[model samples]
Target: MKINYSPSKNAFYEEEHKERYLLSGSWPGDLIEVSRDDFIEYGGNPPEGKTRAPGPDNKPAWLTIPLDFVEQAKAENKRHTDEANNYINEQQWPSKLMLGRLSDDEKLLFNKWLDYLDALKEIDVSGAPDILWPTPPAEPAS
Candidate 1:
């Protein structure tokens, strides 16, 4: 079977170590090899290429990662997201829904986060800002 990197995953294997790079926990797992077809599909770059390998053309252009490592990384990421979502629901949601609206201090904090969320798509997982639910729309004019 061929191993392809999960697009949803934020971690990868460094060609230098020939081991998976975990963005968080360094869990142990069995080593898995990638098939030639899968490697070609991933556009894997050969390690060191001509300078170190048999030659640039002779080597593949991708690195392989352990299958178990991929699963572990995905699970860890999910756990983090779930915890953050729960915190937002419990801590931030009620504050936002209060009848009188947020205090100046709260509003400032929320707006800052709103701005940050607007820029979140471009951020890496490690750099992502706290979860910020959308603010309610302003009331209509009298």
Candidate 2:
């Protein structure tokens, strides 16, 4: 008996006995044991199973804020801004607060609050549509 093999599927078949078997050893390349007449008459085409397409080359775009969460986020941002502003008003800059008299922790806290205020100034409150997600780069030609 002669052995026939399909490297793509990692399988083998015995020619005269007409038996099929999964490959147990390393492939020996594309070897056909049956005569062309026998192969054409009996063997039909080999199965080509489904193959997965390659994944996108670039990373997926970031998720946008859902419509339901937008209002909540705006409210939280407003609350934080108000608290920071209140702290600033009570401290009164140019007084001991800004005169380098405060402790290191106090100075750090003040700087952080100032940074928060600066960031709040940049926030867009116009409730713009959420179509600003980054797009993956186009796939290269095959």
Alpha-carbon RMSD to native, per candidate: 14.4, 21.1
- Over 102-124, each residue of candidate 1 has an lDDT whose tens digit, in order, gives 67765664555445445433323
Q: What TM-score would every model get versus the actual structure?
A: 0.33, 0.32
For each candidate, what is the lDDT?
Answer: 0.41, 0.48
Candidate 2 TM-score over all chains jointly:
0.32
lDDT, model 2, position 113 = 67
